[model samples]
Structures are given as structure tokens and as C-alpha cells.
Target: MNKPKYGPPHHSASPRYTGLRTYMKLPNVNDPHELNDADIAIVGLPFDTAASYRSGARFGPAGIREISMLLRPANAFHKINPFDYCSVIDFGDLPLIPGHIHDSYDVMKEAYRQFAKHNVVPIGLGGDHSVTLGELRGLAEVYGPLSLVHFDAHGDTWDNYWGKKYTHGTPFRRAAEEQIIDPNSSIQIGLRGTVYSPDDMDAAKEMGFQILTAEEARELAPKQLSEAIRSRVGNKPVFLTFDIDFFDPAYAPGTGTPEPGGFTSVEGLSFVRHLPLVNYVGFDLVEVLPALDQSEITAQLGAAIVYEFITIMALKNRDGKT
Candidate 1:
């Protein structure tokens, strides 16, 4: 038998429904040596053990990949083709330990470390928000103390959840405590909904993260929010994390935690489009629960967001910005 070809299958040669389903039909390169020359690597982190609500996010990576088959090479909004500007490939998924958050985090971090070694910017499809701690640990090893730009309906900055220190709701707090991210330069946008305590926001504020409530974000123009983000990050190596719950439940209902009054899909894309100038080191889109997705809307939106992240990289490459 012949070895399968890597990268996206040609639409003319093969239908979108056929072939191995890599992200956006990109090449699959699992060997670090093969990935050394790649500009962007797409990987799946399919572990959701720490989720406080739904547990189906463990299937998020495959969900996103399945819908991403519809993505074409060109991004009409950005007016650039990501594959044309960068060598993007799928690095497959990391080997995560089931039912063990700490061990899974370690595996995630080690995988990212390998990507960082070759200057490959990783665009991760996440398991849960807790997986971000591992991503930060890995990226920070390459670029010390990264500036974070987090988009989510909740802060995920609570000190702890139910006496456990490593739940999805507590990753950012752990990141802040461990200095995986530069708290002063970090920002969390789209935070809203009821909380366990009024001090929930206070705790995140105390950690030095600039919090922008979903209401405030809705009030600001996309340009204004973009300026706020660029101002806060200020030339630092940045890690951008987007939780699917950042979108209004109407737009993305497949997340573990859904909150009202969040950004619409158009608004979310507009916000992301304005972020090409940020010094992004890595990016991830997490907490996409396919079980709750209505008509695959959430998964499609998640795939579009990942596509936009690639467009950002393409824009940067085109302008020589990053």
C-alpha cells in the first residue's frame, strides 16, 4: 500500500466529503522534523476532564475538524489566502491522559514545547479552558511571561472550584499565580453572567487582569476594543485564547457554559480581524461541545474562528507585521 499524501486534498481532485479530515484540509505532519519548516501548526487538545458543567468538549477537536472541511484557502474578509502565505499543517492531537488534569496539562505543554522549538505558531483546538494552562506553560517556555488576550463569557480566573485547584474555571488564576502570563499586560473580555460570589470579578481584578464585561464590550466599537487590547499588550509576546462561550448562546450553544449578552458571530469576527497587529505567539479556540450544538452551528462558528486566526497569521505574513 502507498503512503497517504499530507496537506489538504485538492477539491478538484477529491470531493470535500472524501479523504482524511485534517483541519481545513491541511497536510498532516506528525513528525517534529517534518514540521520544522512549517509556519503554522494546527493541533487538537481533546481533554475536558476539568469541565464544571458539560463533559462533551473532549470531542471538540474532531467536531471542529469535521466542519472545517468547508473552509476554502482564501479568506474574503482579510483578502489573503493563509495557505498561500504560510506553510500550515495539521500536527494531529496531543496524547492526553484521561481523567487526570495535571498529567494532561503536562502532555499538552510538552507538545507545545516541541512546536515552539521550531518557531511553529500553534493554533490549538481545545478540550476545555483548563487546557490553556498547559498551553501557557509551553508557550511561556519559548516566549517568557506572555501577554494574554482572553475572550470568554466567564473570567476563568476564580482561585479554585469546589476545593479543586485545577478546574476549567481556575486556569487563568493558576496561570497568573505561576507567572505563566504577565498579569499586568493581560486582558479578559466578554465576562458576564451570574457568579458564585460578587468577589469573583474582584479576584480577577486583584490578579492584575483588565476585565471587560460583556456589556462593556458590546458598548465599545470593535476598533475601540482592538485599541484597548493593543494598548494593554504593548509589544509583548501574546497568547490569544478564545472560548466558544464568548459568543452569545444563540450564536454558539455548544459550549460547556453558556452566557447571555455575549458578542454575535459578526461582532466576534470583527473583533478578531482588528487583532492582526498584536504580537501573537500562539492561539487556541476551546470549549466547543458538539453535543449541544444545534444544526452544527456552534462547530461551524468555531471552525470560522479558527479560520480567522489563520487569516491573522496570513495578514501578518503578508504585511511582515509579526
Candidate 2:
């Protein structure tokens, strides 16, 4: 008897990135019934009304999933294969309550809260940074106050939006105030752009967040930067949020806001690959606007970046606890 070789199905000619082709499974599942169980939940939020500058982040979540059709070399970076580590499945986007931002927020909170209850970690596809607030609320509900490692071009720590309190720019402000995340343990990296007033940075500092501007990241070698982040976050459970605009605009041209010089793709990937000093819990990859992009490259990059995140979660040692 011959062994089944790894490639296309011998005759069927579909190519694969991870050598697998799986799509978002459904909502409210421990794992897809097809697998009998899942270890990580991949969900789409697909709403970005909270966006201030650009309006297409509503398309980000689905666009990311559509391009994730490439997942490969799954075992290359690890001693154990990822599929053998954590079972991952797409839980379709939350049924967003249209025209109701508050209701939509509640839906996102409820959606992720269910998975957190199952001891499943989440790799969220975003509607905007606002969706992160709901996701954090869910995680905080279960994990206790979290330590965050934020990678983005803006801090997203503003106080309020046009007298409204729950926009994308204010998730961290709300999260910090609620004690849902530990301000002392959390660190924000790759910050750039001029979104807020002068007081915003002061506010972020006052809240106890450790902020590293994008310029600082460029000054350090990758290893040094990674070490600095781990040291600052220390040994606590940490959640990572990567806003795609954290990349230099030359590489990521399709985000709602583009910054001129930021972390190179290699720098960004290396920065994430070495995160330590924390229990790895949840993650979100946000702000990839497909409509502004050509050739779907931005969305494709988002998919690859999310896959990198999934691999990191899978790399966590089994004996470890979030």
C-alpha cells in the first residue's frame, strides 16, 4: 500500500497556502461539529461605523477571511504541528444589529464572551478598533484584568467621540477605566499619526500605559525591540492587537489611515514572533480596508498576519494556562 502524499488531491488542481482550505464555520460553536471540537475561534465583526477618517473598515473582516485561503508550512516554525496543537475554525460574523452601534457592541461582546467561557482563545477579524472593546470586555469577564500588547499607528485611547463614549478611538480609555485591562502591565507599540489633541498622549500616560512611538521601534534592532516589549509586559496574560497601519504605508497601502514610516513587514513579524513574559490569550488584526487596495494585497497581507497570530497561539506550551 502506498502512503497518501502531501499536495493537491493528486488530480484536483487547487493550490493551498497552509495546504488546507477551510472557511468560517458558524456561530456559537465550541468547534465546528465537523471536527467534534475547536480550540480557537476565528470570528468576523465586519462593522466600522466608528471610523473617523476612512469608512471602509466595515469590509475588513470578511475581506480578511476571503484571502485566508492560503495557510501553509504549518509545522515549519514549530516542533509540533499547529493543527495538532489547537483546533481553529471560523465562526461566521456576528449578526450585527444594523444602524444600532450600541446593539452591535452588545452583539460583539456576547459573541466573544461565549467562546471565552469555553476556555477557547480568539483571533478576531475586526470591524474597527471599537470591536476590540467588546472583545476585551468578554475576555476580561473571564480572564480577569488583562495585560495588553497593542501594535498600531494610533493609541486608540481617546476619551469620547462627539459626546459619544464608545467609538474605536476610546476602547482603551473605557477598558482601562473599567479595570478590564491592567494599565500598568499593558504597552502600546508602533504609535504614530496625529489623530488626537495634545492632551491625548498625556491622557494615555496618566492612565498608566507604556507607550512606544513608531520612531522608537525604528531606532531599535528587532531583537532589542522584542526584548523591550517582553520586559515591559512582564509575566502576565497578554492580549495583542495589531492594527495594519502599524506597517509602513509602502507595504500596507490599504488601511483607513496610512503613515509614512513605520515598522517594516519583517520588523512587524519579528516583533510579534518573540513576544514573551505573558500568558498569550486573545488577538485582533485590524484596519485592512480592501476597497482602497489594488489586487487584494492588503487583505491578503491581513490574512497572513492573522495566520501568524494563530501560529503563535498554537505555539504556546500545553502546560501553560491563559
**Which candidate leads in TM-score?**
1
Please, what are the lDDT tens digits per residue for candidate 2 over residues 97-176?
54577788787777666777776677888777888888888788887888888989989988887998878778899999
Candidate 1 local lDDT, 41-154, one digit each (tens): 898999988999888898999999999988776788777766667778899899897799888888888888888888889999988899999999998898889999999999
Model 2 backbone overlap count:
6
CA error at residue 300 for candidate 2, angstroms: 1.7
10 residues in a row with least lDDT, candidate 2:
1-10
Q: lDDT of all predictions, in order shown?
A: 0.88, 0.73
Model 2 lDDT on a 0 to 1 scale: 0.73
Against the hidden reference, what TM-scores do the models get? 0.96, 0.86
Runs in model 1 lying further than 4 Å from the true structure: 1-7
Q: Which stretches of candidate 2 lie over 4 Å from their true place?
A: 1-14, 17-36, 73-80, 318-322
TM-score of 2: 0.86
